[model samples]
Target: MSMAKDKELVLSHISLEVRKLIKMYAAVNECTQVEMLERIVLEWNAQQSRTERPPGDEDE
Candidate 1:
């Protein structure tokens, strides 16, 4: 399975403070900002997948 086919490009807006924070975190972690954002998003997705869903929500 190619994940490239499952992904979509997105544009987002964030406050300057948040942008600066991301940049600093990326620098400290020795990664580009884009990689840092992807890591955060992938971790969130993993967390969501591990969460239990409410009854009758299986179709989603």
Candidate 2:
């Protein structure tokens, strides 16, 4: 297939995977998909921010 077709296929697969993940998390956590996604994004952002800091920067 052409490069455009390949990109579309990859995006489609990613979309499906995201939907499945949302459904699974919502069912397991007893929360709406949006709530679960919000929590996940917040945690991810916190982790990323922490990683960007220097080693001795964390307070006890």
Candidate 3:
């Protein structure tokens, strides 16, 4: 699927409960919702990259 379509599919699958949780966490952490989401996405991407890297790769 195209990137835009994938993004839409992902967004559509998110439940209201999860959305509320994200908002609550953002509020409790004193950060904007978008900032919190960006941090989460970055962290997840980093983790995926690390896992996909070679075992001997220390640069990760």
Provide the overall lDDT of each model, using Cα atoms, as 2-decimal numbers: 0.65, 0.69, 0.69
Off by over 4 Å in 2: 1-14
Q: Using Cα atoms with residue i matched to residue i, what is each candidate's TM-score against the true structure?
A: 0.60, 0.70, 0.68
Return the clash pairs for model 3, or none: none
Where is model 1 poorest over a 10-residue stretch in terms of lDDT?
2-11
Candidate 3 local distance difference test against the native: 0.69
Summarize candidate 3's per-residue lDDT along 1-60 as a digit string, tens digits: 123335445544668887678688899999865566666777888899889988787863
Q: How far is candidate 2 from the true structure (C-alpha RMSD, Å)?
A: 8.8
Q: In candidate 1, how many clashes are counted?
A: 0
lDDT of 2: 0.69
Span of ten consecutive residues with least summed lDDT in model 3: 1-10
Ranking of predictions according to TM-score: 2, 3, 1
